[model samples]
Target: MAVDPRGADLARLISEDPGGPVVMLNLLRFAPDGAAAYQEYSRRAAEFLHKYGGRVLYGGQGSTALVAETGQAWDAVLVVWYPSRDAFSSMVADPGYLEITSLRTQALSEAVLQATVPWPGFGES
Candidate 1:
């Protein structure tokens, strides 16, 4: 089987950044036993991300606020920012972050990752 290292990649990418925004579209499958663990891990992750100057601008459950229609009631949503792409890359290379990978994987049944970049619009904030 092909081993997916995305969890590690995302964690490290956000953990070492000096400050910027990274938005995560969390699609956590509902599992009562895993909710607390997932949240705990996310909190710790936020701490690490902040150390890199990253900030989670907002995080909440999706309702009519999201663009896409999803059947699952995702546990939560997360948005974070890192200094730059290079800073994000640096975090991905850090070996120390490998330890937290399982915690994230264990707490969720599914997750989707997407990369977003800003687009300038006329008279639009």
Candidate 2:
């Protein structure tokens, strides 16, 4: 499973900009002994996120699913909010941030990263 985004994927993410903040939904499946590595990645990533006007809205280990497909269970879930799509793009493109990406790659056996849009009448805006 590929954890790192490709150049084309980044390009597409930027091109499809809806012009506002974006919440990234991350579903991660950790490799053996990967949790500790991911924790280190998170610690370092927090700084870059702050620099880019982003933050982790929520993060937690996955639990037993009440409802889901056979292969839909994830080991962890994270929701990161960026001030804008461009902010997220810039963060990922930063040289310093790029150097730390290997930690995330090494920590995950599989991952899903998706940009989420807020809907009307949702929980907090």
Candidate 3:
């Protein structure tokens, strides 16, 4: 699911609890002020996420490759891991998160938050 800055359509998506493993990704585009603000928000939000079994698997302003079948380019990436879809939903429902959402919407030029089901080939070694 993609939530734009407007955040007008999150009501239905946030209400459902699918109860399976979930990954929440925050894709950060280049904006010095926005990046700084999001980092601060992320630090605080991480604390709250842990209470409900949300583990931040990886987060950084690091290089990553995005090959688009539709032919596009993406810059930096941030990823968080949640125990289950229910846990993911709970994180968003938290009162503190509501406040943070306002800040995130402003900081991020565009944000794509999606629910993913791991492929069978995922995590192969």
lDDT of 1 by residue, 42-113 (tens): 766665676556666677765564555556456667665666755555554556544665667777666654
Q: Per-residue lDDT tens digits of candidate 3, residues 1-125?
A: 23352233345445554556777776666444787777777777877788888877776664445656542334456677888766766777788877777556656665666666677788868
Candidate number with greatest lDDT: 2
Residue ranges of candidate 3 with Cα displaced over 4 Å? 1-19, 30-32, 62-72
Query: Model 3 lDDT vs. the true structure?
Result: 0.65
Give candidate 2 misplaced runs (Cα > 4 Å).
Answer: none
Per-candidate RMSD vs. true structure? 5.5, 1.2, 3.8
Tell me the number of clashing residue pairs for each predicted model.
10, 0, 0
Best by TM-score: 2
Candidate 3 pairs with clashing backbones: none
Candidate 1 Cα outliers beyond 4 Å, as residue runs = 1-24, 30-32, 64-73, 122-125
Better by lDDT, candidate 3 or 2:
2
